[model samples]
Target: MSTATATPEGALPHRDLSHTPWRVLVLGATSGIAEATARIWAREGANIFLVARNADRINAVAADLRVRGAAYVETAVADLDDIDGHTALLGRAITALGGLDVAYLAVGILGEQPRAEQDTTHALHILHTNLTAPVSLLTWLSNYCVNQGFGTLAVLSSVAGERGRKSNYVYGASKAGLTAFLGGLRNRVDREGVHVLTIKPGPVRTSMTTGMKGSEKFADPDKVAREIARAIDKKQDVLYTPFQWRPIMAVIRAIPERIFKKLNL
Candidate 1:
């Protein structure tokens, strides 16, 4: 599969997108939340570049976006965990889209916690995919946006990161590290005119949570996507989707570690 797509000749390098379609790059284009958010952007006639490891699925997403009224749609197949290829992939995305207005990162894994507890390799794999890979992508993206003095970096983190629960502490650790990285990235780039939005979602319904207990009770991914789109438009620094996770996580964070460790989460 081709790692990148072609851009039209004479595509504008960069411009104020307020009057034109927003150019967007979605890292985990096949993820439920990212795809849903892209659909909203498509309805606004955005130019979009989708990057994901799955060719068939990403192509379907691109076709859907095109039919939904995206001004331009392109897809590149890539395994985001392969950090060495990120620079090249990101370069291709920018070249294809002409410029990037928003980059949404939704790549992550909810690994088996039981296996992670007993196996160092499994735990490290989760950390690498969820934490290390995103950090690498954001590092490059932040520098690019800083140089341009414009762009939005919206990342999908989880409220589970607020406090470590015995059930999924490994996954939570990955998100916690990501949340910290975004916070620091925002502190560095906001003054340079770059917006870094840290999205903390509380168990939304998606492929990752398909078989989990109480999946029906999970927040709708579409609703979460709408909130995310609004947050980016407003240049909000942090968002807790469903509007309840903010206070929920706040209470969770405020619980004393002494008492928190004793209760089942």
Candidate 2:
């Protein structure tokens, strides 16, 4: 009953979409990195479905993509936190696209550590948003991809997930869960010809971190977007934005637990 495509190249970078126009769905389309990626896809004349909570924001993004020479652009506004809506939302996305070639999930939140530590409610919301919701959506999408047999799935995890830091362990724990999920999902689906990419971005200068200082190490979303496009074209398994975060996190994870805990992150 699977309608999966037997394409060896997967949805992305298996072939150039410059002329063929692959269909792409961008979840959390309003995020800075997602917005930048959508623009890159637009330049290749890809058809895109933008999903986000804000209708007006998604509309503006759609207009920009249309103007950028996207073959087709549409919007589906919904808060990604609503796990119950994922099935209907993804169903609508694939239906609008006619079929799905690639889906980029770029939804998450940076909850306040202080608040999370003080209140179980705050902690649970962060966990649900970053871990539970994405898991639910990815499970659905993975099944769809398996049955369809052709697609690329990329998710935005965080380098903070590499190892839990005291400052943002709640956020870190969520991403850590997501990262593990992606790894398992990738193993299960790759043989079926689906590309599952786990993207870990370090500090990013965006609306979420606007007021936070110490952004000197933050990667530019535009630059990060371009790199992501290249990685997709190559059908990569894991990508660390700006290419430097990999080693940075590697060293951090390599430290002994006793030593790591003693040092301030």
Candidate 3:
């Protein structure tokens, strides 16, 4: 894609990709939330470049999106944990899409707390996948968007990140790290004509959470995707799926440490 030669003179021009036929890069493209969002984008006729560890699944998703009205659909198979390949993969995505209008990073893994506590390697692996690798990708994309002068960087975070819970503190910590990273990155990149949206959603019905029991409060991935699309259009800083999650997390965060520690989350 052709880009302007010089930086804009003042505040960035307003641009929204939600309903337009724009270019989008969906990292972790085969994941439930990512795939759901892809469908929404497809219905709006966006051109999509998808990257995920599962080649077969991504190929199927790409095909399905074509039928859903996507102007173009392309797929690449790779694990986000392989940080060494991030620069090249992102480069390929930008080239394939002409310009990346939005990049949704939905790559993460949940770890068993008992196993993580007992094995150093297990905890590190979760940290690597959930936090380290994503930071690398976001850093690279940040610079690109800054130079190109427009892009939306939306990363999937979790409400668990708001506070450490005994049930899933290990996974929660990784998410907390992600949440902090996005917060700082957003502040750094906002003025660069980039909108960094930190998407914090409560549990959603997905294969990843299939083993999670008693998910009465869980939501549908499609519904969460719709809210995400809305956030992108509005260039929201932090988005809580279901909207109710915003106040819920706020209450969770406001609890004093002394009182918070005394009660089970």
* TM-score quality measure for candidate 1: 0.94
User: How much does candidate 3 score in TM-score?
Assistant: 0.91
Q: List the residue pairs that clash in candidate 2.
A: 3-148, 4-148, 4-149
Go through the candidates in order and give each one's C-alpha lDDT: 0.90, 0.86, 0.86
What is the clash count for each candidate, in the order shown?
0, 3, 0
**Residue 137 accuracy (lDDT) in model 2:** 79
Candidate 3 lDDT over residue span 1-265, tens digit each: 1221322224433455454668899999988999999999899899999999887899999999999999999988998888777777788787888777799999988878889989999999989999989888888888778877888999999998989977788889999999999999988988878899999999898887886776655898999999999899888999888788889989988998989888865
Worst 10 residues of 3 by lDDT: 1-10
Candidate 2 lDDT, 23-92, residue by residue in tens: 8999999998999999999998998999999888889999999999999998988988887677777887
Candidate 1 residue-wise lDDT, 1-265, digit = tens: 2222323234334436565688899999999999999999999999999999999999999999999999999999999989888878898898888778899999999999999999999999999999999988888888788777778999999998888999999999999999999999999989988899999999999999998899999999999999999999898999999898888888888999999999988
How well does candidate 1 match the true structure, expressed as C-alpha RMSD? 3.7
C-alpha RMSD by candidate, in order: 3.7, 4.1, 4.5
Runs of candidate 3 with Cα error greater than 4 angstroms are 1-20
Best by TM-score: 1
Which should have the higher lDDT, number 1 or number 2?
A: 1
